[model samples]
Target: MRFGIPLLFGCVVAGSVMAVSCKRGEHVWTAPDTVNIPHNTSGELIRYGRELIVHTAMYLGPEGKVATISNGMNCQNCHLEAGTKFMGNNFAATAANYPRYRERSGSIESLDKRINDCLIRSLNGSPLDRNSHEMQAMIAYIEWVGMTVNNGAKPPGSGIRELPYLLRAADTSKGRLVFDNKCRECHGTDGTGKYDSLTKEYVYPPLWGPHSYNNGAGIFRLSKFAGYVKANMPLNNARLTDEEAWDVAAFVNSQPRTEKLFEKDWPDLNTKPPDVATAPFADTFSAVQHKYGPFGVIVKSRKKH
Candidate 1:
C-alpha cells in the first residue's frame, strides 16, 4: 500500500507548464471525491449511480420502481464506501479492466454484465436492463472512479485482498464464538443485522435470512467472504485474524439465505472457483466441503488436471 506523489508540474507543451495529479498504488486505491465533478448531466448521472449502489434495495428491491431483482441488501454491503475503499472489495479499477474476457461466463463481458451478475447472484435479484438509466448511472459512477486507471492494469487495492488459506478446514464452531465476541454488537446475536428506523433502512445489514444475499453471491464463496471479513468487518473496525475471518465467513454463509437463482453459471467447469455452491461439479468433493472448505485439496487437484 505504497503512495506516490499525486501532483506533478512540468513540460513545455505550447510553452505552458501544467500541473497534474496521478493516482498510484499497488495494494490500495483511493477513489477521487465526487465533489470534484462539475455540475453537469454526467456529474448528475455519476451521483445517481453512487446513490443506486448505496441504496440499491430502495431502488431495486421488492418495492423499487425500476425492478425488483435483489434481496434487501445494498450493493455497498460488499463493495464498501460506494466502491472506493481499498481491501473492501473496492471498484477503483473496475471500469478500466472490464469489457474483458471472464472465465466464469466464458465470454467477453461488459461493465453492465458484471453489475447484473452481482444483481443476479450477490443481491439475490434479477438483472437490470442494460440500457436503463439505472444501469447507465451505475456504470458512469464506476467509470468516473477508474477513468484514470489504465486498461488491463489492476490498480493498487482494486479488489478484495484474499488471505492465505489455512492448512485445515475453517471451523464454524470456532466461528460461532468469534461472532459472539466480535460481531454480535452490530450484526446482532441471531446474525440479523440492525435497522435504522428513521432512515427506514438497515444500519447493519443481515448476514443471513430472507433479506440476505443468495447462495450464488460471491460472499457465499468462503474465500471471498473471508478476505472481506478480515479487512472490513466489525463495522469500520476490522480486527479479525485471517483464520477467524474464514471461520466466521463459514458460519454466516452456512446460515440459510436465498436459494440459488440460476444453475447455468460457469459455462467452463474447469475455471469455476472452488467455493461456488453449485453442485454436480467436475470434482468428487462433497457439497459440505465446497461450502465450508478445506478447499486447498480441490485447488491442488484442479492444478494437476
Candidate 2:
C-alpha cells in the first residue's frame, strides 16, 4: 500500500523562456524560493531537502487507474511519492508541458484538463466540474507540486499514504446504523462498496482494507467523505442532500478498517501523505469542514441524477 506525491529531480525544460509582463499569457520568469534547497549537494540543506522529498512522497495519494475499472483509485496510486524512484511512472513534468495537450477531451488542455484526463481515463470516474473549488484546489496543489523537485518524478501506485485518521470518538454505532439504513443497499451490508466494484472495473474501490487507502490514507473525516459521496454516490445516482451525505458518511466511516501500516517502497517513512496536510478537515474533517450547517454557494445542476 503506497500513496504519495510525485518526486522531481533536477530541472525541467519547457518551451524556450521569454520574459513578459505580469499579463496572464506572458512567459514572465517567476523565481521559486530556493532558500530551503542547498546551493551544493554536500550542503546540509540539500540533505534535508532530499529527506523532505523522500518523506513528502509518503503524503501523495495513489495514482489513478483507468476510469474504466471501479478500482477506487487516484493518480497518486501509481506515481507513488512523486516517482520517489520506487514504483512510479514519472510524469511530474507533464504539468508544465500541458495546456498544450491533445487528449480524449479534444483540443489542447490546461493542467486541470490533464488532471481530468486522468480522472476519466485512469480513475474510471467522471471529470470534475470545470470551475469547481475542489477542481481548482487540486489544480493549484498539483501545479505547486510540479514546480517543486525541478525535474519530473511520479509516485508509485502501491496504495500507501499517511492517511488522515478517522476520529476515534466519531460514534461509529450511529454511523453504522445510518450506513445500514441508507448506504447498505449500494455499498453492501459489508461496507465494501461492492455494488460499484461489480458494476465498474477498477473504478469504485472498497472504502477500506487492501483495495482502498491504507491506514496512512486515513480518509476518515466526514466532510471529504461526504463531499465525495454527496457529489457522486449511489453509482451515478448523486444528488444527496448535505445532511443525508453527512449521515451517510457517519455510517460508512464507522465500519472497521485495518490498522496495519502499508510498506511499498515509500520514499520516506518520516514524511506523511500530501492529502493529510491539504485534507479539508484532516482527521476530524466532519466536525470542522461542515456537517448539518449552512451549505451556501451550492449548485443545482441537472445531470443524470
Candidate 3:
C-alpha cells in the first residue's frame, strides 16, 4: 500500500507534542533536544515510508477503493489534521511499555498483537504478521521514536514518553469523572465495550476487561490514550479536553478486566475472523448496525473549510 506526505508522528517534548513528518529519501540524525532527521537522502527505505503514508490516504479517501468513512474524506483527512494531537498510544513508546501483557484472550500478549488490533480498529485494515516487512518498517519508525524519548538511548518507553518535557502525566481521579460523563453511556460502568455474540466481537468492549488487557499487555497509561480518545474515539464523535481524555482513561484502565496471560505476536500466524467466545449481545450488534447504521466519515464532516 502506498502512502502520502508526512502528516503525523510527533515527538512529545516538554509535555508538548511536536509534529515530525517523515520525508521521502531522508534519514535524519540530530541531537536529543532537536529533530534533525536527514532531509535530502536518496534512500529507498526512507522514501518508502513517505509514499506509504500518501497511498494509504488515497485508499481511505471518499472516492478511493475501500474507503472506510462515509463522509467521503480520505484517511489522510483525519490523520493529517490532528494525528499528532491524537497520537494516543499509537506512538511507539506505548508499545515499548509492553512486551508481555495480559489480554482478553486469557493469555499474555506482545506489542505486535496490539498493533494488529489497532490496525483493525483505527486503520480499518487487515492485520500484519509480526515478521511482515511492513510491520517491521512501522516498528522501525516507532523504535526511532523510542530512541528519541530516551534521549538517543535505546530504552523501553524510550520514545516520546521519555522526552525532556513531561506531558500532563496520567491522572486517575480526574479521568474517572470524564469517563462517567462521556464514555459511560456506551462502554458501560466497567469500561468494557458492549459485545455482540452473533457478531462474535465487541460492540463496545471495555478497554480493560476480561476481553481487555492486564499484566502481560502494555499497561494502560493516560497521555497516549487521552490523545486518541479526545479525537478518534466514541466513533470519532468526541470533543474532550486533553486533561479529561487522559483522566477518563486512567479511571477506566484502573479497573481489572482480564488478566490471564496470552501471546499475540504470531509472526507466522494467520488470524481468521473472530469467533465470538461468549457475546451476550451478538444478535443485537448485527441488528443495530444493519438496521440503524450511519455509513461513511462523519467527523468535521464538511469537505471544505
Per-residue alpha-carbon lDDT of candidate 2 for residues 10-84, written as tens digits (9 for 90 to 100): 111133221111232222122233353335633443334333223221222232221132235544433334333
What does candidate 1 score on TM?
Answer: 0.88
Once model 3 is optimally superposed onto the true structure by TM-score, how far is the C-alpha of residue 197 displaced, in angstroms?
Answer: 2.2
Better candidate number, 1 or 2, judged by TM-score: 1
lDDT for model 1: 0.79
Q: Candidate 1 at residue 270, lDDT? A: 78
Write model 3 residue lDDT over 1-305, tens digit each, in one string: 11122223443333544344333432222222213334554233433433333343333322334343221212222233211223333342433455554435445667677656544434433455678655565454444334433332222211222111123344567777777778788878876566544433344544664445432333243333444566455554656765565566566656765443234332222221111112222222332221111211111122222
Best by lDDT: 1
Candidate lDDT scores, in order, read 0.79, 0.39, 0.41
Question: Which ranking of candidates, highest lDDT first?
Answer: 1, 3, 2
Error of 3 at 162 (Å): 10
Candidate No. with top TM-score: 1
The TM-score between candidate 3 and the true structure equals 0.38
At residue 157, what lDDT does model 2 achieve?
A: 18
- Residue 150 lDDT, candidate 2, scale 0-100: 37
Model 2 error, position 109 (Å): 22
**Candidate 2 lowest-lDDT run of ten:** 295-304
lDDT of 1 by residue, 1-305 (tens): 22323323322222332222224322234677777876999999999999998988788877665677777778987888888876678887798888999877788999999999998878777899999999999999999877767888875456876677887888989999999999999889987898765554577888898888878777788999998888778867777888999999988887887786455678877778888767768899988888777888989988888
